[model samples]
Target: MTRESLCRLDEKPCDVELRRRRQDWRRGAEAAYRYRQREEHLDVPYEHVETVGAFPLGRWLSDQRRAYRAGTMTGERAAELEKLGIVWDTADHGFEQNLAAARAYYDLHGTLAAPRHATALDLAVGQWLTNVRRPGGLGKDPGRAQRRAAALAAIDPDWNPRERGWTVDWQRHHTYLAQLLAEGARLTAVVPGVTWHGEDVGRWLATQRRDWGRLSAEQQRRLGELGVRKAPRARRTAAKTAAASGPRTGGAAFQKGLKALQQYIAREGGLPGRAVVERLPDGTEHRTGIWIANQKARRDKLDQAQLQALADLGIEWA
Candidate 1:
């Protein structure tokens, strides 16, 4: 065959390949359109596959994202995807989704101190916040990270508890107490059993007062803003005297056990297993499961008040 004929033969295969690619692109685009119609958004999860025509729409979209990021995507294709509400930067898109959830949480609680398992707007915003608060968790792009941080700060200035020299648990309790105060509740009324959002606010407040000296100056300042003050010297002296006395009397021991049980319930949201050992904030440990068993075993000898306290905590045998 002449050289011209050979060149045409090679060109024919290239043309066929190009046509095949175009057909594939059309099929993918149709699937994407259907997805957007149903979901009202083009933020498909990476592992998702469109059921229609069994197209790998998620993977296809991911490939398109990679191409866009690499500046390899054609202008026509980019425009087409944009028309379908496709977010070119998936990382930024994901951040925005979690940010929406964080905002909803803040609106409801007036704080962003959500627990690690907390969910809002069907998103694991607590975990997202935890991850993003970590160094480099917002990705390696400094500009993008700064923007994300700013968005979070706009919602809650103390969104990162560690940066404020406090734990999320501390911030959560503080927020609850602040809310109660805002609603006109007096500090004296925040006694043990006064709970807010499942937190033992009264117990937490007592702890803060008793251990006020342990808190940083900034922490003390924040608490002071809410009218929380350190325990009086006389009360502290009386506490020390009681500590010097032998092992706690029955009533004292029971109160301690009750506090530990409350802490467990607040943390776990349920009864502790038989093998559980609970630790209190003061560094004391309680064999909570065994204590509960003992209490049940001799419940007949217990006072009415003790029985009632156990019953209040959902103890079946109480």
Candidate 2:
């Protein structure tokens, strides 16, 4: 054979072809390179096997694709899937595409269909549905919007978009939520007839402001950016302030016990034990030894002022 016709391994005749095949495989190209290798008896170092005998491979791959679309399947998992010949279209079209699809379906058919693509986008669409429809707007594909459901189901047979997952796209969801909420949109706007925790954004915001400490740091930061500042704590009224400043009942109880100790020390010439302290009180006969013991056991619970009061009496606590 002539130099051009003779395919030499040293000349790397398949290098460019192999690179092209790798690109195709990465893009999920169906043409099998392994089958070609077998047919031609090509001594290619790299072998491509279509199926690893992974049952429900389609669904597994589909979920991974959906995750990649939602921007959640990054890092090692994504790389591992790539190694398995699953290529991810890295550009995030989930929000934009799903939003457009939702708006189109709503505009065309006058009903809301949750995006079957990504959970984050679906949530966003649900939020939007809340705004357009009042108190109870177009309830989710209420007539069992078969066309919309079918379209999504075709992509994923188990396309229960509302079903919760551990790996939710929180950042995307929050960003979309913050944007929609800032534009005077409510959660029910997307999820028609459903109030988040039985309240709209306005009511929720008021409650959130009232219970700011319960919120996470990320939530606080996000809400802060959205101009939802925690309201300053209400100052106590003069009467309330005076009541708070009044002598604690606990101090009085401690003082009564201290006075009994002093009397016992003066009268009996010894520190009061559990028996002595219990016997000193009028209601003491019914009280258990455990209850009397607990008073001494809980010495640390006393306020510093109460401890100081005991210290001034030259009574050392055990």
Candidate 3:
């Protein structure tokens, strides 16, 4: 999700000017809180006092947490939040315990079962399991998986770690849906575009069968802003074109070179100098097409799309 979408989800207005204003307001709030403490001759926790204008710091903190969990927040941003006392440590927030419980349940059942007795925490962990992307999209990181398996085994000694999590379908069951409906929850909001009312459920389900919340063009752009990987459709299209045109020639090679350049920028956290690009993970040797693209971009010759691609990877050429 883009920062705008995250702000929307958190019910905050996304204004660059407003963000600047909030920083000043935050300092004022801290000052006022201290003044009131002295005036009242009381030692009160900062959390207990409501600041003037009741600025939405609580909501902002929650938004930061969500952004961090989604892997969209930068390290600098996280540090700023930490300074404001919004802890981002997953262990302190009980995520480890929750994850371990979910792992144990999966070990026993061999699936992320949506039972009638499932708690919100259970459903949350299941959702995470269902959506968590493996690094590089190559496969599960073996070391991390093994460590998780060991941790789960401590909880349930018979838990087998070798069982593949992907083999089990992670989709919610009808029973889970019925429970959600019974709780007066709006299913459409829970899983976007899937209405689950008395009559519209069937219609909505059929519509979902056709297209279940496929990303719009604008959302695709937003995903780029959020530093999420590009959709498989782009890769598939490139592959098809390559197959029809025979071996990759000038254009295709240039495209690959551009991609490699982007990856290098992302991994290195900057525009690579000629010497640095030579040693970058995906970068080609000096003076190749990828290197030339990097040089052209460094000289500010690329269009907005190319520049924005680099920006999405957190690369600021300057």
Query: Which one is best on TM-score?
Result: 1
Ten-residue region with minimum lDDT total, candidate 2: 188-197
Between candidates 1 and 3, name the one with more favorable lDDT. Answer: 1
Q: What overall lDDT goes with each candidate model?
A: 0.85, 0.46, 0.45
lDDT tens per residue, model 2, 1-318? 345653553445567677775564344422223323445521112333335332333444555578788987557766655444444432223323554655564443233433223233235655543332233232255453444445544543323322322112332333334644544443222221212222232344555677888767766786677766776876669558747799655655655565454434433434445554334434443232333355557877876766665555444673
Model 2 error, position 232 (Å): 1.6
Model 1: worst 10 consecutive residues (lDDT sum): 183-192
Clashing pairs in 1: none
RMSD of 2: 21.5
lDDT of 2 at 116: 28
**Could you report the Cα RMSD, in angstroms, for every candidate shown?**
10.7, 21.5, 28.3
Point to the candidate with the largest lDDT: 1
Q: Rank the candidates by TM-score, best first.
A: 1, 3, 2
Which parts of model 3 have CA positions greater than 4 angstroms off?
1-254, 262-270, 277-301
lDDT of 3 by residue, 1-318 (tens): 577776776744456557876685465436444544556422223354345555444444455568799998778766654554445644334536566666665554443442334334345654444333233221266665566545545544433212423122212223234444454443322222233222233233333334424635443343334233332334788788868989633345444445555434323334455544333233335343345555455545555655555455444572
Report residue 28 deviation for candidate 3 (angstroms).
80
TM-scores, each model vs. reference: 0.67, 0.22, 0.24
lDDT of 1 by residue, 1-318 (tens): 455775877656567678889999999889999999999999898888887778999999988889898998799999999999999887787888899999999999888999999999999998988998889988898998888889999999999999999999999999999987676655655667667888889889999999999999999999999989999767787677877885544567887778777666754567887778987767888988888888888888888878988887889889
Q: After superposition, how far is residue 256 of candidate 2 from its true place, in Å?
A: 50
